[model samples]
Target: MLKIQDIRELIKAIDQSSIEEFKYEQDGTKITMRKERKMIEQVQQVVQQAPISIPQQVVTTVQPQVENIVEKEVKQETPAVKPTNLHKITSPMVGTFYSSPSPDSAPYIKVGDQVKSDSVVCIVEAMKLMNEIEAEIKGEIVEILVENGQLVEYGQELFLVKPE
Candidate 1:
């Protein structure tokens, strides 16, 4: 049996890492995951019983923050100006990231999908409650920062958009 605080801590730690997906299994218990990328998106965390102990393997895959590092190295070549063209849609809560309403449903938006404000872009389920996330700024979804079913943090970036 796992304590509530233990699971909460694990969730927090996962949110801070570059790894976008993670799962934990022990004997008859299992936990599935999903995370948001640029902004706030909801999450659906499902815990259930398993017939066998699902092997515990932590695989990390993150879109590198390479630009940040490269910027430091090329201090002289930089124009010393900031980019002002990108707009971000953020999650209002900490949860999972989903491109569709359900597993069998088609995603609302894809990488190149053009969208308007108030468009439902994804769903995040937390504490067994599903929440719909909307795009408040019209734009093209440039990058999906999260993988399906990964856990996320409060105020996390869910999407990167190029505003129209």
Candidate 2:
């Protein structure tokens, strides 16, 4: 029989791995694990339910009389610069981001802080469990892309790091 710790280790391995499904059986004791497709469907449903706000903001800010002038001025402004050497740290699963282990504790990382491969950079809370995310690469943190407590999707960019 599989112990609780063995099951937990299996789950962790599944979470960190690319495998979508797994099954095992020994003497009629069976175990099965699969990554749910419902997650993507739920995300799509939430997106559809949420109202689009960007167009409303633009409409409220720009007056009809000066719209043309403002459009030209906006077009002329320089676009935000994206660093070429920066590597994106993305979310491994859908969850809420926590910068610190606890509310009263200091954050795991900050902008300009150096990190090595295997360094725990933040925690993601999913289904009441806290999963610590590692840096996976040696780098200096250049930007934090999500706010604390923000819900992040699978593969969403969480931070930008300039590799050492």
Candidate 3:
């Protein structure tokens, strides 16, 4: 059983030593020190001028709060509707979007290129493997949504397909 007087004595010793931090533990008591630069400088000036010791102890305990949410009862804000003119070709997996399968080869397709269903539109590089993404609809490519060598997230739109 450690008494409060022991804590006072340890603080006094720390003040006399001119140290920044001090820690001591005896049985059930654990005392930790955090020294402020301004307080230390003031104490040093006072000690040099008159040599008086003051000990102040502070203990802080914080309990983490848990967030409670009832989904059925919670009022959620719905996003405003967005209008899309062209049919979008979205990535099925996370990968680097590639216009061509090989570096020296011409791009599989470009904007204004007409494509049939099952035609290879682009290749996506995922985990060192090249995946050929096919055009699901026979259409003219209206726009390219992403650039070659660009990092594409899962379900990210890659191209805009307009049916011929």
Q: Where is model 3 more than 4 Å wrong at Cα?
A: 1-85
Which scores greater on lDDT, model 1 or model 2? 2
Q: What is each predicted model's overall lDDT from 0 to 1?
A: 0.72, 0.82, 0.72
Tens-digit per-residue lDDT, 1-164, candidate 3: 65545545665566567698877677766666644455544755564577433333211222121112223212232333433666788998766789997899999998999999899999887667899999998988988988778766678899988877
5-96, model 2: which lDDT tens digit per residue?
57667867886787889999998988767664456456556655874355766777765745785466456443568889899999998677
Relative to the unseen true structure, what is the C-alpha lDDT of residue 48 in candidate 3, on a scale of 0 to 100?
Answer: 52
- Number of the top-ranking candidate, with lDDT as the measure: 2
Please, what are the lDDT tens digits per residue for candidate 1 over residues 1-164? 66756777788877678778888898888886555564311211111122223233411232244446445545633445535687878877766778888899998899989989999988887667899989998989888887787766667888888898
| Ranking according to TM-score, highest score first | 1, 2, 3
Between prediction 2 and prediction 3, the one with superior TM-score is 2
Off by over 4 Å in 1: 1-9, 14-83
How far off is residue 66 in model 1, in Å?
A: 23
